[model samples]
Target chain A: IAGITQAPTSQILAAGRRMTLRCTQDMRHNAMYWYRQDLGLGLRLIHYSNTAGTTGKGEVPDGYSVSRANTDDFPLTLASAVPSQTSVYFCASSDGQGAEAFFGQGTRLTVV
Target chain B: TQLLEQSPQFLSIQEGENLTVYCNSSSVFSSLQWYRQEPGEGPVLLVTVVTGGEVKKLKRLTFQFGDARKDSSLHITAAQPGDTGLYLCAGWANNLFFGTGTRLTVIP
Candidate 1:
């Protein structure tokens, strides 16, 4: 009842199409992150927001963009989806110190 | 970019066996954490070790942080089917960097 929530549990998108993954947390944490989980690659950071209205690129930020319009929401958008962009996306939140991260269930997206 | 590499990408063992999974990195971290993830779900934090050479235990699972703060390990005693999952290690600096992860399967 009090944690991160990711919408569109799973999706299938055509190539060159646009898609957005929604993430919302009720904890009001200061930090939010987006990551893509692939087979054998683990979870690679896509984008991160230290606080409201601030965003930074992570290890793999290509083809993806994120905006932290407010403390409760951080949405990841794929301007033009590709086959390689298909993967499980996760949203996580941590405190200001970045001690521990609480994650959402994840969204499974497939680009064909 | 800092990379955390986990050894033995995948492992399958019989129930009641003991096993160890290692997470190695060249970059020293202020802290390290372990997480367990099951299919169709996100990873859940298991333990966090900050100080170098620190060891923390939770039930049958023991976690150790390298003295140099660049590596860590998880040892499970008497593995059980319930312990089967993908184990991940993350290093903490200004942000968190994760390893490739080790998938473990325990058979009954």
Candidate 2:
């Protein structure tokens, strides 16, 4: 089962452009998250959705936004990409709080 | 924000050798999780220790969580080359805070 899958495995976009990274899960999990990994900085949460119709800001939420329209998908958008946004993005989900999470392959975004 | 500090930022050793990686923090957590991630792949959970002073074993890997819930460790015995990956420890506060991963390279 493709537990979780992210679209646009890698992307290169010019600054000031808008882009959305797609994430989907087949497990029907209730919690979904977005995180970015930078060298030596660890993975920091960008945004998260506790369930459909509800979202919350995470540790690093500026420059990024997310929406959870249904249980299967939660997409992260960069309305105005910047060079500082170059990083690998990951999508994850859990059946519930404090549970084991499954992650997507990842989206490597380069904002030039 | 709660912070998790992992030690031995990098580790390289030959097969059959033993090594330990640590994750420490000043903030107590309700639960801590361990994940191993490879290049091009997202972090995958290896295990979770919720109880203070708890210990869990997965094959050759032994995981321990400090009673104070402020530290954790993973010890690998007779490590194999397949064990190479970035190991991370995460602490939870409603959401999880990941530590600087310990990159392990097991030489064959």
Candidate 3:
């Protein structure tokens, strides 16, 4: 059903560059989230959108931003990539708050 | 900030062995969820426990929520090579707070 689709499955970017990780879901979920997974440091929420046209900061919101223009799309952007930002980024969505969340395949980002 | 802590960050065992993983937190949660992630993939939900002291079983996996709803445990019996993956616990306190995750490797 293509529950969630993420673009640029893997990317290698130079520091100080701008990048956007695209995420789209067909489930029409109202809540979407962006998280980064690093070794020894599970998934840390970067940003979240309770519904379209609204967004909020998560645990690790620095250096990252997200926009939920509609129910199906929530994109996360890195204003200026840094080497420390290299990690696997995951996009997830749920029917509503506290519901089981389904995640995208993931975007492997490597900044040099 | 609410934090979920998972013990034994990594584990390796022979196939058919039994093992247990733990997830603990200082804050109480209305619900807790368990997820498993394999290489090059995102975490996928395995089960969710809503009530305190609830126990749920899924084939060889057994999940239990603490009476206080501040802790959880996952026990796998007769593990197989296919059971290898990263196990994560997430608690719902307004939002989901994920644990550090336990990486399990079952060798044949």
Q: Clash totals for all models, in order?
A: 0, 0, 0
Candidate 1 backbone collisions, by pair: none
- Candidate 2 docks at the CAPRI level of medium
- Give residue A52's lDDT in candidate 2 (0 to 100): 97
Chain B vs. true chain B: TM-score for each candidate?
Answer: 0.97, 0.97, 0.98
lDDT of 2 by residue, A46-71 (tens): 99998999999998899999999999
The regions of model 2 sitting more than 4 angstroms off are none
Write the residue-wise lDDT of candidate 2 on B5-106 in tens digits. 898999999999999999999998899999999999999999999999999999999999999999999999999999999999998778877998999999
Colliding pairs, model 3: none
Model 1: docking quality category: medium
> What shift in Å separates residue A90 of candidate 3 from its native position after superposition?
0.2
Interface RMSD, every prediction, one decimal place: 1.6, 1.7, 1.6
Q: State the lDDT of candidate 3 residue by residue for B42-105, as single tens digits.
A: 8999999999999999999999999999999999999999999999999987777899999999
lDDT by residue for model 1 (B58-81), tens: 999999999999999999999999
Report the lDDT of model 1 for residue A93: 95
- Put down candidate 3 lDDT per residue, A1-112, tens digits, no spaces: 9999999999999999999999999998999999999999899989998899999998999999888888999999999999999999999999876699999999999999
